[model samples]
Target chain A: MKLYALNMIQPVGEKPPPEALDKVMAELAEVRRDLESQEAWVFGRPLHGPEASTVVRLRDDEVIATDGPWTEGKEFIGGIIIIEVEDLDAALQVAARYTRVTGLPMEVRPFQGLI
Target chain B: MSVLVRVFGDVDVAEEAVQDAFAEAVRRWPADGAPPSPAGWIITTARNKAIDRLRREAAREGKQAQAVLVNVAEPVEEGVVRDERLRLMFTCCHPALALQARVALTLRLLGGLTTAEIARAFLVPEATMAQRLVRAKGKIRDAGIPYRVPEEADLPGRLTGVLAVIYLVFNQGYGGRDELAAEAIRLGRVLAELMADEPEVLGLLALMLLIESRKGARMRDGELILLADQDRALWDRGLVDEGQALVRRCLRRNRPGPYQIQAAINAVHGDAARAEETDWRQILQLYDQLMGVAPSPVAALNRAVAVAEVEGVEEALAVVDGLDLGHYYLFHAIRADLLRRLGRREAAAAAYDEAIGRTENEAELAFLRRRRVSVCG
Candidate 1:
């Protein structure tokens, strides 16, 4: 078995209307329930917007801190879910389901361990 | 190679073992008479070679290599090799890999062509092609792209990727490399046999055979010849017959797809003994059906050529002008032909110049240049 991280890519802009967001959240909850039933879900949660994020770095043996995302972009990682599956294909299948429910893109990457 | 890949589940190890087995054969086959079952003998020898290599690696790597070695030690039967080849085909043509990588890997692993040879055929540097093959194999291993046929639910979508890769290889061959075209046809035939019930597979094979049948008449003196001007007598009758038979089988299946429709159109053209005797109405109908099934700017441009024959040059030109195909040389070439036929010499000359500027082929450039001069006169 392998572990994969499905990072939800959210656009950095005004939020959708409440009615639309409510429907999406309901569908997402249903998807989460499905994943839990399959015993594939490990961890999942949404994060605050990128505006609330801070950057910390080390430069010349001195610690540094930044006020915004490491790199400014039109889209940010708004949420993440970790799942255990057999292979990339299975992870992709799960990611596809999440994307369908949330109407957002998901980047599926395998956790590095066995080369 | 396929059998060894199935056994070891590692492309690099499988490839090395197959080469080692062949080297062993070259050394011993001259001294001893050829074995009755040469294929079985090679499979056994390759399997043994892979086991030896894995054992050596396992000694250094410890547990991980030892676990893989245990899996590699299983014996593979010769009869299952055919299925293994099919599995290998699916893996090499997996949708996860880029199209160029898939084509290069297919030719290398299944076609048994050297990287240098594949490089020459695709017009890429040997080092670049070698790197591409290595990256593709690494991705397949790292991404855990399974070396097995997809389940029935995913077969249609996955099969489309495989067929597209084969067709792309055939088109690359059609450009100038006859050997690549031959290899594509051989792969198509193997696919057809393995998936005999698949109408689209048969359609693709027939489509290639029909186009290849006219290869003898496609060029003359290193210059391009239009299909209408080619000598019908030069066409291979045997290939035409075989291709037409496959088309008939597809027709009986009553399942229509883009490749099958294109093959049917070619079969229609093959029925004509002379170019003037060609049935424009039937060809146009097929194009309409093709557009319905798989609509694209290229297909629309091709459909315009048939419209010129059936409807008139004015109507065809109207359709061509509406298409957003400014970047395609064939779009300009077809527009030039239609304009010339309508006595619009100035417009025709400009369109011919567009085609001349767009195309890079020496033979095609020569033809376009000659046509451009004729328009001026």
Candidate 2:
């Protein structure tokens, strides 16, 4: 088995309808619970909006600080889930299902080195 | 390698253990006599080696995945050892890797050639080949590419990649080295046996055999001899018979593919007892079928040659002129011949000059230069 990071990407200002959001949230909760019970879920968490993000860099031994995500991309990483799976096909299926439940586009990338 | 990789689920560890097992075999086999099943012995030893290595690593990392190796007690079957080779072939031909990387990895993993040897064969630096292997291996591991042969639905697409790699190996040897050609024939035999029902596999085997059958007369005195000028008696009749037989078998399947069509075309050439006896009309039809199924400029170029034989030089010249293969040396060489046959001496000489400029092989350059001399003179 290998661990994959499924990063949820969401538009910065777009929000679903109140009822749609509620239903999606409920489905997300159920799916997460099922994954946790199956021991496939390793860790997961939602993130604050990109406005609250901070960037820190070191240049020529001088500290520099900035606000916002790394780039000015319209969509930002809203949340992420880590799961242990057998192969790329399994990881892709999990990512697709997660997107269907949460209404968020997901990017799945495998972690290097075995657990 | 495939069995060990599946068991360990890690390319690096599987490779190391297989190497170690081979080393142990070299040390122990002479004294104890060869085992009844050498492959079975190696797999068992490699599996034990992997388990031991994982056990030691688990003590340090304490990971759950590493701990799972403690329960690895699957029986090693001889059938699995055979199937695993097919699995390895599929993995090497995975579409995710670049074509060059796929070919290099296949040569290294399945063909059992060292990186330096592969580099030499492909005319690249050893370091570049080494890096390509490392990168391809890393990608396979990080992407979690499964080490299993594709399902029935994906076989056609995946098999194309495998066949291309095999033919590339054959061509690499066809350039000069007999050893590489012989190895490719052996691999082709294995593929033909394993994929007995595939018409294209049979086609590829037949094509390789037909072309390689002329190895003895393909060259003389370090110079490439044109097919028309080569001594017919030097051709290997045994190989020609076998190749023609395979082509006949492919025709019976009634499922024509590019490779099968090409093999059928070569079979037509093999049927000729002398150069003047060649049935160009039959060859031209096969090329037309080949162009329909696998249309490429190279195939078109070859079709033009056959057209010249069946049709006149003017007709063939018209067909060749329509093709977009200005950079191909054979295109220029063939054009030169067509121009010469049409009595356009200066144009033929110019085309031969272009052919000599575009080619890399010393023998080919020599042949082209000789053609240029005759055309200019």
Candidate 3:
């Protein structure tokens, strides 16, 4: 099975002014609805504003939590869905929808059963 | 040599025979006893299997030609095995193939990587990569791309494709998602070793070593670490030193290529005690030269980052503002950081969101999610 990460696009700030959120997610939800038939999608939840998100890492045997997304950037993942497509073209079709909906990008990956 | 010898010595058939021999060994070796020379036993078994297969195939055709050829088939030839493999590589790297297919074919054959492994590395589906491989191999067969080292006249033109194949393999490995990263490195190492006299090959290896040195430190568990966050103590000093030496050698040769220039940039990153100490000016110069040789928007964006360090955030933003890299995560990420530094928290956060949206990496997404929290706070 192919694995794709369908990243939800959102603008920066604690909240994407509810209007911006609605505009973007309307597009995303359309993509979400369209892609469900193409492949299997994992958990479906948009990212909370950065404040609500936590960065977690494992050090030695413990878990470390930090502010949020490690890189310094503005656009962040609002939510995610994983799809198992048959081929890269099919996967690209899924990613293309997100871009079509929001004029943004989503990375497509095929899951290797083993790392 | 009879046509029989050619078929028996063919790469695909030989590979199948060898696989069968190895499988038979695994079954019979335990039942009997380990041969005095296991490798020798396997080679012999495979050759004999090929001869038998040829005979059987001929027998099925009810032709004595097969029996005649088998009788004429000489004892196992030692050098032919390596020749076939080399022949395969030569065809796989033929200039006729697309850049992606070259690396895909190399990884599939030379590196012993499965289609699934290469697909994972490049972040594409397995079936697509598998088709790409098939198409590449078929192209080799259709165009009659020769299975020999390219002629000296063709070398200059084809060298770029060869180096590209090496770099492509390296990137697949470096891309972090695919297991082909190690395979890419192996391909690079082999290319370097094959062209040891050529300094650029060494530069490619050094460059890969330099960047790969920090691979472990780049990610802590599954979370990403910016250059500054990476612990210097965890860095591989051995790789750093070796890569530096190699880059120095390549620069001295004065016949620099993109790989050599890229190696120089990585060398600076590898040698810096801290991100602050990084020789951004030298990197910028290399990027300038790199852009001339291989112009890419990503390179320009990177150069913009260097400009930011030397000049200011506004200047850097302006450099990338009109560029066309809408779907790239790094461009958005860099823009977000620059805006954030300028205290345009709202805009910066928005850019960050754009970066996160572009990328599928969980660690990067998680990091972006948390950054939004801090920006609004």
Candidate 4:
């Protein structure tokens, strides 16, 4: 068995239009329901946008805090879902379904170590 | 090895126990002569060692798997050892591990090869190979990958992966690493003996034997000898006989597969009394059948070469020109040979340059350069 993380990433500082968001939410609910029935879905939740992110660094004797993300002009994880499956193919199928409903790129990575 | 793994319920611990049992044998076998049942002795000793190790760990952690350990430590039956090794092969070649890892694990555990030897064969740092083996073993342990042979329905897919690893080991050995070739032969022989009913297994053993027989004459001094230029007397006739016998056995089964077809081709090559006596028409027919089943570009390339030998250069050249193997070094090399035979010197020289550019093998590059000079100069 394997656990894969499907990270839904989108460009920073961007949001879907309200009507598109509604459509996606509806589709996602149905997807989540199907995944739940299959016992494939473990957990999923939307993430806070990049504006609320913070960065911290330890310099010499002081800890410095910054207001923005560590990097800019890039796609950031907008939400994430975890799925347990037998192999990569099963994980890929789940990712493809999520991509169809969410209209965002989903990066599927296997969770290392026992899960 | 698989029996030990199942008994211990952990690959690392089982391997360590087996190693300890071998060490014990080394120390005791010389003085005590030998045991009546050597394999049974080793299995019993390894089981005891594993139980001791488990007891030590359990005592430290206050765990109670000691009862289970005691239960599994009973001497395994002799009849199960062969089946256990088959399961071990399936686990070692499990698809979850990386391809290189599969090859490394198969060589290490099944072939009894040292990590250093495997690293040298692959030209990787010893540390990297060690880490790869560790990671693969860890995956097998943590991912709950069952250490057992696949069922009849799953055997085809699973067995193919095992055969591929064995063949890869053989090819690596064929590329000037003599020990790897020997190791592959040993592993192949084991597979043949254990799976005697499986035609492909016999076919693979025959293929390795036929190819390995020619290795003695493949090189003269330090120079590579083309097949036609090799001294036929130097070939290992015993291996050739054995390989031909295996080919006949596979043919009698009437279950033709790629490996069986390949073994038959080599048998044809090995059967020739002299280079000129090679039955190119029969080879071409076998290659046609091979292309039908396997359908790889390399098979098509080999078939074209066979065509050149049996038919005319023009017919073969037309076949080669239709192939989309421009990036492959052997494709260019064969093209150069065909063009040179057709008296297209300038085109042949160009093809040799492409072949040289694509190849990194020092010996092969030297051969190509010599061919280029003979053609263009």
Return the DockQ of model 1.
0.62
Better of 1 and 3 by lDDT: 1
- Using Cα atoms with residue i matched to residue i, what is each candidate's TM-score against the true structure? 0.95, 0.82, 0.67, 0.80
User: Which scores better on DockQ, 1 or 2?
Assistant: 1
Q: What tens-digit string does per-residue lDDT give for candidate 2 at B54-111?
A: 7778877886566585446666788888788888888888876899998888888888
lDDT of 3 by residue, A33-81 (tens): 7666644555467567666777889999999888867765677776676
lDDT of 1 at B288: 100
Ranking by DockQ: 1, 2, 4, 3
Worst 10 residues of 2 chain A by lDDT: A87-96
* Model 1 agreement with the true structure over B260-366: per-residue lDDT tens digits: 99999999989999999999999999999999999999999999999999999999999999999999999999999999999999999999999999989887888
User: Top model by DockQ, which number?
Assistant: 1
Residues forming the 10-long window of minimal summed lDDT in candidate 4 chain A: A86-95
Interface RMSD of each: 1.3, 0.8, 12.6, 5.0
The model with the greater TM-score, 2 or 4, is 2
lDDT of each: 0.89, 0.87, 0.72, 0.88
Give the top-scoring candidate (lDDT). 1
Write model 3 residue lDDT over B1-377, tens digit each, in one string: 11212454334555566678878998998899998766556667776787777678778988666446544334445455555544566667775578789888877777877789778777799999978987876655433345655657556556667767877777756656445666666767766766677777787888888888888788776777888789988888988898899998897889888788888988888878988898888888888999998788988998898888877889998998968998999899888888888889999888888898898877777777777678876
| Better model by lDDT: candidate 1 vs candidate 4 | 1
Give the per-residue lDDT digits (tens) of candidate 4, residues B51-121.
88788888889887653646555566778888888888988998878999999999998888889999999
Instruction: Calculate DockQ per candidate and list them.
Output: 0.62, 0.61, 0.01, 0.10
